[model samples]
Target: MTRSVETTSSEDSELSLPAPKERRRLREAAELTHDEIAAAVGVTAATVRSWESGRTAPRGRKRELYTQFLARLAARRQDGGPAGPPGEAKTARAAEEPAADPPVPDPPTGDTPTPDPPASDRPTPDTPASDRPTPDTPASDAPSPDARTEPEQLPAEPPARVPVPGPAEAFDALYALAARDLARQAYLLTGRGALALEAVEKAFVQAWDRWPEVATDPDPVGWVRAIAYEYALSPWHRFRRAHRQLDKPPAEPADRILLDALLALAPANRRTVLLYDGVGLDLPDTAAETEATTPTAGHRLVHAHADLADRIPELADVPLEKQSALLRDLFTALRPAVDLEPRPAAVVRGGGERRTRLWTRATLSLTAMIAVSTSYTLMTAPTHYEPPPAPGESVSGVPPLAGPQQLTERGKQLHDKLRADPEAGPARIAPRIE
Candidate 1:
């Protein structure tokens, strides 16, 4: 009687109540473990449990993350249709049932009158069966040895099932965009063309595997570019035997003078500058991705430009403000250059700039002009023609303009600036070039 009286008195003055409605909302949205939610929100699992149970409440970003988590979960469920959660009885039931599609009609009885063909094919009683081939065969059709003449023996092995791509094959185009962007950025970052290509390819392959999430991201390429940079800077890359700085100078091209300037800075500054310059990420985004300050990113870009001027004296002629613009154009052109690398069918889009098609048309136009000139020349003088013999050795047609040497040259320019800058002249500078 005393315990009941105390419980009733406490209930009358209730101030703190458990948030059961909020907990139920979260629970219905996803099958998140308490630990996972807590870890994401920087809280303990016990705290998460208390919150979920309405014994406590989370606030700020923690709450926001939870809400996002639920939203993402809901999106995934909606995509998969109204089956209960995956692996549940409802899902299993749907899997077991045949899909209601490709409707089949009842077979017609032989006694039913058949409809005649249209006016063009109106065959009367006077028409003969011999005038046309039977329904089972066309005029050119024939039963091969492996056909219905006999029960054919099975092959030694069944052919492997190749995956059929769906009509929605634009994933490859999206992937190529990400790869091209990452490759250009990586090239600017490492000043090593091959490494940049490899890094971008790896990142793109990973992105392709998670195309669904990537498709929804506003800046998929930006996400990939950041991930690629991180991959290049990972422990295996940084602390391993391959940790030496790029030793050789990049090949040179006259037109690539401006790009050759930007690729000249130290790796850190290279990344910061390139993230802003190459990928078109804003200063804050660059800093966030690179784990640097906005001011630091700005400084890095300034230092990068200065270094570019130092190494490539010609770059000094270009105004500092114009250097950024020049670098942007250089990278824009280089994107297509690296994209020349062979990629899977899924990775090429039909609608983008068709270089081959354009080239073919241009070639044909030039050939027509040459043909007209040759015809007139032949009429003026009877010329004896002797064709040169083909060379014995095979040559790869104009060995793909060896990875933009100009970008690397620009990189060296920045490196030189770092060496000369009084502020960067600290212990970081070494006389012995790596």
Candidate 2:
């Protein structure tokens, strides 16, 4: 197919790259951000970082694109443009340095020292009469300023003044580097693209809240990655309405199979495989990150490999390490470019601060309520028990029915007779009772 040929051509056209260090140096020299490079190359910023770290290299379309970008970056330096990225003041300062008078070179020497010419041969208008050397002066004496013949000394390179990014800038830079990769990794763990991005953003938000601690951590990227992974793989996410549905699988059959195999894994085995393979972590590190003992981590990895082999027959033939690379490839196919954009660093940080404040307020209110209730109870509660109230005696003689008293049988009869006598009612009044 045309696609196969294109991929082959791209892979075959790998550029003769410099040392991995050179790649990083070039980018830094240009003051380019990792996100910019990653975006242009159709890969995640983490992938770009790994490339510069020499832990991994791009292949296929990625290789061709990355090579082209690096080449351009190098060319930009060669073109005599500003050493820093365009529009930086560093270029202007660098320009001014070359214009400054270069350091004067020492006079050339030979076995027979060349004689200094008399003051008549070279006009020493600026030289003082006493300082000017005559023909009688020995060559060993300090040469007059005009007699200094060495080529103009090149300007000393200004101490490489690298601008240190501020805390907010540093956090944003880290976010730019790790956010995309974390999002992709999260997508690999959870089938939903939206949830994956959400998890990544949430991880950054948490990191921002604890910026001091996170920034000081030895492996800030790994710290963020671990948090993202935890959020993505959390069982509680399954309970969320939004995450209940799975995202569509990658359109390519190969990528879809890889994803399906990964999803079939139990979360532990899945996480172990991902950390060990997908992220290119060593065995010990994978175990430590997963919070498992080495032996347990190894077993999980074995099981994961077996499951993947069974589900993806082709992988059975590949070596364990290469399988990890293939796993990484699946992340890029999970979503398109538009969906991959994570929330901005500023927005994420602000949200985190707000969330922390809300929790703090809620906690203080709850504590206040508990304290008030305790004080009120202490004040109102009796110090000792009082004597009990007496029990009521049983009542006898009262009618069971509760209502106005019933008329006697005689009175009822007389009432009935009066009713029968009609107009005689007045005479038949109850006065008889009196």
Candidate 3:
């Protein structure tokens, strides 16, 4: 009597999953590097390498996700699309190039070339050529004849020209240049791609609101990066963590363990390590951003380094100066996989203002109510009634007469005694009263 064996379709599918090496081959064929595939699969590059080396394999949902991602990547590659995160290659290219100035419109030209304006009336070199009034315009349109004649007296000191890059333009330029890098840093801080992008967008919105101040600052990128870091570390994110699902599958145990160790440090220590080691901020700058003294920031960094070294002994051999670069590379390789669309500037600003106003109003109302209640209680409360002192008695706990009649009689007696003893000594009156 032999028992027949039965297997469900799901079991069969699980059994038929590709070997770890095969998976790696598929990913490589799709033009995806270990880090790229790791990001797509929400695991560390080490885990991807482990998979390729057949030392470990993804299981359950992660295995399914890895398969799906590879398939999609292969399809995209076949279609001749770039095989990495959107804008990633472009951002890298842009960083390699010189800072790009905003595009200026070409100056309008007529059939004939116009001669340059006179030296005295010539526009400054910094001014865009298009902004200059066309010399070809009729004399009537070239400012009022009276105005030109009046300005001929002097150049009027160039109208106290403002800085060329206005706040709005400066902010736009900075956003274009630094948004990707800022988001990447945020991802390192938060270990969640969506949260990181959200934090960056929020920081940008704040920067936009205060663009005049931010643009004039010595380090606007640092300012925005600090904001993103603080936003990523907000406690509110913990509550949202469970609800915020990643598009990519869960990370491997080693990756998860490493992230847990990093996060287990105190917030200050974690922030110090991330900024100093991961983001390459100097102690003073990190201190300024974290609102600590440089010495304190340094201490925090040391402790953080020790903690990390305990978890990852490989870091112990890294040089002090190169540790930052090493940590940065590590985080970049492990960045989470997600693409985010930034909220519109207007929407973000409006929502932030609404929340601030609501909070302000609530706080003011609460304070006013407390003040009113306190005032009412103080005004209506019963007061202590201290009786008037009787004759021959001080208010300092002196015993009073038994009755009003007794007090009047005592006063009368004292008056009579004093009148009778006008020529007598005060000792005689005191003896009589006793």
TM-score on alpha carbons, each prediction = 0.36, 0.56, 0.40
Quote the positional error of residue 412 for candidate 3 in Å: 72
The best candidate by TM-score is 2
Q: What residue runs in model 1 are displaced by over 4 Å at the alpha carbon? A: 1-168, 238-264, 332-342, 345-434
Q: Per-residue lDDT of 52-81 in model 1, one digit per residue for the tens?
A: 666444432344555565555545556657
Weakest lDDT window of 10 consecutive positions for candidate 2: 1-10
| Model 3 backbone overlap count | 0
In candidate 2, what are the lDDT values of residues 1-434, reduced to their tens digit? Answer: 00111223322354366668988887787667798787687656777888899876665445667778888777767766557544452331253365668796676666767676565766568878888667688866956656675677798987988998878999999999989878777877877889989989888988888889998886798899989998888899778898898887766666677788889999999898877666756565677899999799989989998899898766676677556555444444344322667988988988888999999999999999999999999999999999999899989998687786788999899879867886575665556653
CA lDDT of each prediction against the hidden true structure: 0.58, 0.75, 0.66
Candidate 3, which segments miss by more than 4 Å at Cα? Answer: 1-166, 241-258, 316-322, 340-434
| TM-score of candidate 3 on Cα atoms, chains taken together | 0.40
TM-score of 2: 0.56
Residue 100 C-alpha lDDT in model 3: 68
Residues 287-346, model 3: lDDT tens digits: 778999978998998888778767754456766644555555455445344654455444
Q: Rank the candidates by lDDT, best first.
A: 2, 3, 1
